[model samples]
Target: MRSVSIKELLTGKQLLQEITVNGWVRTFRSNRFIALNDGSTLHNIQCVVDFEKFDDAILKHVNTGAALKITGTLVESQGKGQSVEIQVRDIFVHGGADPEVYPIQPKKHSLEFLREKAHLRVRTNTFSAVMRVRSALAFAIHQYFRDNGFYYFHAPIITGSDAEGAGEMFRVTTLDEKNPPLKEDGTVDFKEDFFGKETNLTVSGQLEAEAYAMALGKVYTFGPTFRAENSNTSRHLAEFWMIEPEMAFYDLDANMDLAEDFIKYVIRYVLDHCEEDLKFLETRLLDEEKTKPQAERSEMALIEKLKFITDNNFKRVTYTEAIEILRNSSPNKKKKFQYLIDEWGADLQSEHERYLVEKHFKCPVILFDYPAKIKAFYMRLNEDGKTVRAMDILFPGIGEIVGGSQREERLDVLKQKMAALDIPEEELWWYLDLRKFGTAVHSGFGLGFERLVLFATGMGNIRDVIPFPRTPQNAEF
Candidate 1:
C-alpha cells in the first residue's frame, strides 16, 4: 500500500480506506491508541491497535519517539481532539526508541531544554510548528519580492569589504592562526592566504546588492550573514539570515514605503498560508504570557497583533522630532531611561525604541534621518548635513526590525564622506565606480530573517526561531 502522511489522513474528505502511514510515535496509551506525527502538520493522526492481534514483543516497542510503519484503515475519529484516526491492520517497528534512552519525552519540555537537544527538538509540537511557520514565511518573502518585479540577486558570502563599517567580522582564513608568515615590516602577510588578501564572511550583502541594482534596476538578496560581535543578548546571534532589497531610482520615502509594504505582505502571506501552525503558536504565546503580571501582559493577542500590523499604517517620525519628544517625555525627565536622551545626536537605545513603538505610537513606527555620525558612511547626507537619510522600523516587542537608507548618489559627496570616515577608498573603487559612472537616487533596507520569524511566531528569544543558533562559545549542534 502507498504511504499517506498523517496530515493527509487528518484532512482527507473520505475515510475507511486501507493505507500505509509512516511516522514517529508521539504517545502510545492503553496499549490501544498511538499518536503519530510525520512533521507535516502540528496535529497528529491517532492509530488504534488491538492488543490481542499483536505479539507482546511488537507491542512492547510501541512507545513514544519510536519509528513505525503501519498499514491501517483511515476512519473518522471518535476521539475528542482529532477529526480522523487510523485502525491498524499490520504494524512494522522500523526503529524502537527505548523509553529510558530517548531524549524527547511525551511530557512538556522547556524551550531551553529543547535548545540543548537541538537535533531532536523538531519531534516536539512547538518546534515543529515554529519551523513550519518559518519555512512558510521564507517562501512568503521570496513570493512578495518576485511579485513586485524585483530580480533575486546572490551576493558573495566571502567579501573583502566591511559594508556596515562595524568592524565586527568573522575572518575567513586558510592560514595558520598560531604562527604565520610575516612581511618585511613584521606584519602578517595576508597575500599568502586563500584570496591573496584579507576576506571575511559577509557582514551584510547591501553593498553587492547595490552594485547589482544599478545594473538590474531592482534586486534583492536573501542569504546568511555573520557577525563577530560578542553580544550575548536574546536578540543577538553570531550567524543569521538577512533579506536586503536595493533599488536604482528610489528615495528614502519610497524605501520606507517599500519596507512597510514588504513586511505587511509577507506577514499576511504567513497568516493566510500557515494557519494551523500560526494558530498553535498563538495559543502557545497566550499560555506563556499567563505567567506574567497583568500590567506586563500584552494588550492584544498574537493573532490580533499580526492583524494590527496589516490593518494600521506605520507612524513615520523624524529623528529630530523623536529626540525632542524623548527629551521632554516622562521617562527621560524622570530619569527612567538607562541611556537618557538629553541631546539630539545621542543614539536611540532599545528602551527608547520600545517606548515609541509600544507605548507612544502603539504600533509600528518608522524613525528616519538619524545623525550622520551614528549611521553608515554610505547613507545620503541631508541638506542639514548633520543627519543622513536613514530609517529604522521599530515593532512593539522587537526593536529595529528593518534598517535602510538612500545612497549618496553624488560622487564627490560620497568620496568626501569616505575620506572623513577613514574608509579605504581603494578597497571600494568598484563601489565608487557606481557613483563615478551612472548613479541615480537609490535606496534599500535589510530585514533580519530570524528577527522577522521571532516577530511572526511570537517567540521571545532569537535563538528559538533559528534551527541551530550560533552564539557566544555555544556551537553544540
Candidate 2:
C-alpha cells in the first residue's frame, strides 16, 4: 500500500512481500529489467517487469531515466549475486526522460564532466551519497551544540568590518556601480551607501558570536560566509559556511576541549546515522589507499576515536616548537613552499601544517601561540611579545580545519595593536566600547564547514562535498 525505500528493504531479510516503489529509472536492461533509485543510497533496487503483460504503449514510455511508480511482489533472488529482486505487476510512468539527452547513464562519468552538470549531478550514486553524508554532518553539528548547552546565534551576513582582519571580502550594496558616490578627494564616498559606510560580506562570525557569548556565557554561529580572494586552490572557496563558537570565561585549554569534542561529536554522529551511505563511500567513493572493508572499518572505530578525544587529552604544541620541528624536517629541503619556514616568525603553510599533523604527531594536533605579525591584530598578545594567543587545529587529510584565538580584552592593548596595524579606529569603536564597559576573557574558533564535510566523506576536493560550490572561475548550477 505504501512506498518503501531501497535502503530500508536492503537491510531486512523479508522476501516475497508486496511493496510499492517510486523513483526515476537509473538504468534499463533489455525490455524486462530495470534499475530504480530514489536518491536514498548508492545501491539501486532491480525491478523485473514482464514486457508481455504491459501494453506496447506503456513499454515504449518506460525509458531510461524516466520517473516511475511500480507496485510489485518482492522475491528473494535465486541467483547467488543479489539478495532480493522485485517482480513488478503494475507500472505508472510519471515522467519520461529521453536516453540521448540525460547526462548520466549506466556507464561511468568523470568527476570533471559531472561538475559541468552540477544541477543534475545529485542523481549519480557518488554525489547522492556525498549529499546524504553532508546533511548528516550538518545535523550532527547542531545536535552537538544544542546538547552541550550552547546558544545558537545567527550572525549578520553583511558587516562593516572583516572579523578575520583579512582584506579579502565581497562588497554588498545597492549602490550603482557606474555612477558611484565620490568624495572631494576622488575617493568613493561610502557615506552614501546603504549602510552609510563600506560594507562587505562577513569572513567570520567569531567576533559577533563573542558579543552574544559575553552576555549569554556560550554561543555559536553557523552561517554562510564570503571571501573574494582569487586564489584557485582545492582548499579555497569563494562562498562557504563557517561554524564559530565563542565562550566567555574560557581559557585556551577550555577552548581546545570544545574544539576536540565538537569535531569528534560530528564525526561520530555521521558515521552512526549514515551507516549505509558510509559503507557506500568506503567501498566505492574513496580512493583505494583510504578505502577499507566495511567490517574492518567499523562504525565503532569512528565512535571509539570520538570517545577517545572526548575522554582523553589532546596533543598541544606551541608555535615555536612547530617551527623548530619544521626547520629540522626533510620535506623542507625537498618541497618548495610558498612561504619559507626558516625561523619562528614565518607563517605556516598547508604543507607544514600537514607535516605536523600527519608525520610528526600522527593525530589531530593543536598548534597555538603564533607570532603576532602573522596572526590577526585582535588576538591576545602573549607575554613573549613576538607571539599572540592563537590556535589552529590541523588534521591528517585537511591541513587547517579550524582557526581561533583568545580576544584582546584590554582596551589599551587593542587600541595600540590596531594603530600599529593601521586599522581604522572609528570602525572598531563599538568593539572597543565592549571592552571599556565590561570585558571578560573570551575565546572562540571558526571551523570551515565544507572542510569538515570533506574530512567526513573522505572527499578529496572541497567542491565535491558542497552543493553548488562557488569557487574562483567556476559557479556552475
Candidate 3:
C-alpha cells in the first residue's frame, strides 16, 4: 500500500478508509493511543491500537522517538483534542528508541538543553514550528523578488576583498598550519595557496550583487555570510544568512519603501501558509511568558503584533532627530542606559534603537542620515558633508532588522572616501569601474535571515531559529 503522511491523513481529504502512514511516534499513551508526526505540519495524527489483539512484546517498541509504519483505517475520533484518528490493523517498527536512553522524551526541555542536541531538536514542537516558518519565509523572499522582476543572482561564497571593510573575516587557506611557507618579510606567503592570493568566506554579497544589478537592472542575493567576530552575544552569529537586494536608479526613499514592502510581504506570506505552525508558536510563547514577571511580558499577543506591522506604516525618523529624542529621554537623564547618548556622532546602541521603536514610536521605525564616519564608505555623503544617506529599519523586538544606504555614484567622491579609509584601490578596480561607467544611483539593504525568524516565531535566542548555529566555542553540530 502507498504510504501517506500523518499531516495529509488529518486534513480531512477522506475518511472511513484503510491507509498506511509512516512517521516517528511523538507519544505512546495508555499503550493503545499513538501520536505520530512526520514534519509535514505541526499537528499529529492519533493512532489507536487494540491491545487485546496485539502481543505485549510488539507494543513495547512503540516509544517516543521511535519510527513506525502503521496500516490503519481513518475514522472520526472519539477523543476531545483531535478530530480524527487511525484504527491500526497492523504495526511495524521501522526503528526502536529505548525510553531510558532516548534524549527527546515526552517532556518539556529547556532551549539550552535543546541547543546541545541540535541534530534532534527539530523533533520537538517549538523548534519544528520555527523551522517551518523559516522555510516559508525563505520561499516568500524568492517569490517576492521574482514577482517584482528581479533576477536572483548567485554571488560567489569565496571572495578576495571584504565588502564591508569590517576586518573580521575567516581566511580560507590550504597552507600547512604547522610549517607554512614564509616570505622574506617573516609573513606567511599566500602565493602558493589555492587561490594564489588571500581569500576568505564572503562577509556580504552586496558588492557582487551591485555588479549584477548594474547590468541586469535589478538583482538580489540570498546566501551564507561569515564573520569572525568573537563577541558571543544573543544577536551575533559566526555564520549566518543575508538577504541583499540591489536596484539601479533607486534613491534612499525608494530603498526604504522596497524594504518595508518586502518585509511585510514575507510576513503576510507566512501568515497565509503557515497558520498551524504560527498558532502553535503563539501558544508556546503565551505559556512561556507566564513564568516571567508581569512587567517583562509582551504588551500584545504574537498574532496581533504581526497584524499591526502589516496594517501600519513604519515610523520614519532622522539620525539627528533620534539623537535629540534619546538625549532628552528619561533613561539618558537618569543614567540608566549602559551606553549613554552624549552627542551627535555617537552610534546608537540596541537600547537606544529599542527605545525609539518600542517605547517612543510604538511602531517600526526607519532612521536615516547617519554620520559619515559612523557609516560605511560606500554610503552617499549628504550635502552637510558630515552625514551620509544611510538608513536602518528598526523593529520592536529586533533592534535593526534592515540596514541600507544609497551608493556613492560619483567617482571622485568614492575614490576619495576609499583613500581616506586606507582601502586598497587595486583590489576593487572592477568595483570602481562600475562608478566610472554608467553608474546612476543604486541602493540596497541586507536583512539578517535569522533576525526575521526570531521576530516571526517569537524565539528568544538567535541560535534557536537556525538549524546549526555557529558561534564562538560552540560549533559542535
Candidate 4:
C-alpha cells in the first residue's frame, strides 16, 4: 500500500495495488462514482465506491467540494477518458461543503461570476488551468533570465522618486489624515513623516534596476509595482507585476534583439512545459471566439498564435516609417481607424498598432526612433533632435508588448532634458552621478507580466490571468 497523488496513480504504476489518496470530491454522482481531484492535474480520478458497504451517514458527507481521504485498490477502468479507477476500501471525510452554498458547481459559470468568488474559483477547471499556466510562465521568465546571465535585483517597493512619471503613484504615508502637520505654505509637511520625506509605492523599478545593472552588468527586476492611474479598462491594473531587465552596455538595437529573444524563449517554454493546460485554454478560447461574428473571430487558434510569434521574425520599422505606412494605409484613408495617423509625431492608438502588426506586417513589429517629447527623459535622443531612440514591440492583438530604449548617457544632455521638463536636479542627483563617474551605453525594456500572461493564455481580460486582480475599484481578495 502507498499514498500517491491522483496524477501519479493514473499512470498505472499502482494498478492492482492498494493505495491511499487525498483530494476533494468534484462530483459524487449516483453515489457509486466519486470524481476525485487533488489539484495535481486537470483530470480527475474516478473513485468507484460500493455504496452498499458504506453507511449513509458517511456517504451523505461525500458531496461535491468535500475534502476526502480514500484508501482504495487501483484497478483498470472500463470508463472512457480515464485509464484507471479506485476501488474504495475505506473513506474519510476531512471536510465538507454544503451543496447549497458551494458556488463552483460542475457547470459553466461566467467570468464575471468567478471574479466574485476568487477564493474558490481555482477549484474549477478553467481557473485551475489558468493558474497552472500562470505559474509555469512565471517560472519560465525567471529561467530565461537566469540562463541569459541576468541577476535578480530587487528594488524597494516604497521609493522617493517616480520612475515612469509623477502623479501616478500611490502615496505611502503613516501620518495623521484628519489633523496632519502642515507647513507655512499650507502643504502637508512630509518632513515629519515616517521616511522624513515624500514617498510612494514604486510605479516602475527601471531606475533602481539601472543602478544595479551598472554594477551587475545585467540585472532584472520581477516584483509587484503600484500605479495610481484611475483607468477602469481591461488592459490596466492598479497593481501589477513588471519584468524589467537593464543591461549596462547594450544599445537600442541590442535591446530590441534581447526583447525579441527573451519573449520568444518564454513563450516557447510555456508551449512545451504547459502543453496540457494550454491545450485546455486553446479549446476554451476557440469556444469563446465562436460566440463572436465570423469577421470578429481570431485569425488563428490559440496555440497556433503562440507558434506564429515564435516562428516569425519581428518586423523592425522606424516610428516615422510606421507613421507613413499608417497614414497612407487603407484603414486611415477609409476612416476605419478611430485615431488617424495624420503626422509623424502623432501617438498611435491600438487600432493603428493592430493594423501594422496584424494587417500590414503580419508579425510582431518593433517601431523605433519615437518623438522625444512623447518618450521618457531617460531615452537616448537621436541626432535628429526631434526623436529619441525609443522602441516599442507590438504583437498582433497586444499593441505594446514591450517598451525600451538606449538610455541618455551624456550628463550634459540629460541635465538639459531634465531642466526642460522642470524636473529638479536634486530629485535624481544619484542617477546623474552614474553618468558623471563611468556611464556607458545602457538600455532596458519593461514587459507587463499580466499582459504577457493574458496573451499566452489567450485570455481577453487582464484581470482573468492574475489570481487576485487589483483594479481601481476592486481589491476585495
lDDT of candidate 3 over 176-295, digit per residue (tens): 999999999999999989899999999999999999999998999999999999988888899999999999999999999999999999999998998899999999999999999997
lDDT tens per residue, model 2, 1-477 = 888988777665547788898998987778988888888777888889889899988878777689999998888865555688889999999998887797788787877788888888889888898899888888899999899899999999999998777898999887889999899999899899988989999998877887889899999999999999998877889999999999999887788888988887887787678887777666654354346676333322333333433444457999999999898787776555555678768888887897786677766789999989999988999887878899998876567888888888989999999999888889878888879877989899999899888777666678888889898888756
Per-candidate clashes, comma-separated? 0, 0, 0, 0
Can you write out model 1's per-residue Cα lDDT over 1-477, one digit (the tens) per residue? Answer: 788877777777548789999999999999999989999988888899998999999999998999999998888888799888888999999999999989899889898889999999989888999999899999998998889999999999999999999899999999998888789999989999989999999999999999999999999999999999999989999999999999999999999999999999999988898888888999999999999999778777888888878988999999999899889989999998999998879989988998998878888999999999999999999999889999999987777899999999999999999999999899999999999788899999999999999999998899999999999999998
lDDT assessment of candidate 2: 0.83
RMSD of each: 1.2, 3.9, 1.3, 1.1
User: Which model is ahead, 3 or 4, in terms of lDDT?
Assistant: 3
**If both were scored by lDDT, which would come out higher, candidate 2 or candidate 3?**
3
Give the per-residue lDDT digits (tens) of candidate 4, residues 262-313.
Answer: 9999999999988988999999999999899998888988899899899999
Against the unseen true structure, what C-alpha lDDT does each candidate score? 0.92, 0.83, 0.93, 0.92
Best by lDDT: 3
Backbone collision tally, model 4: 0
RMSD of 2: 3.9
* TM-scores, each model vs. reference: 0.98, 0.92, 0.98, 0.98
Clashes of 3: 0
Q: Which stretches of model 1 miss by more than 4 angstroms?
A: none
Supply the global lDDT for candidate 1: 0.92
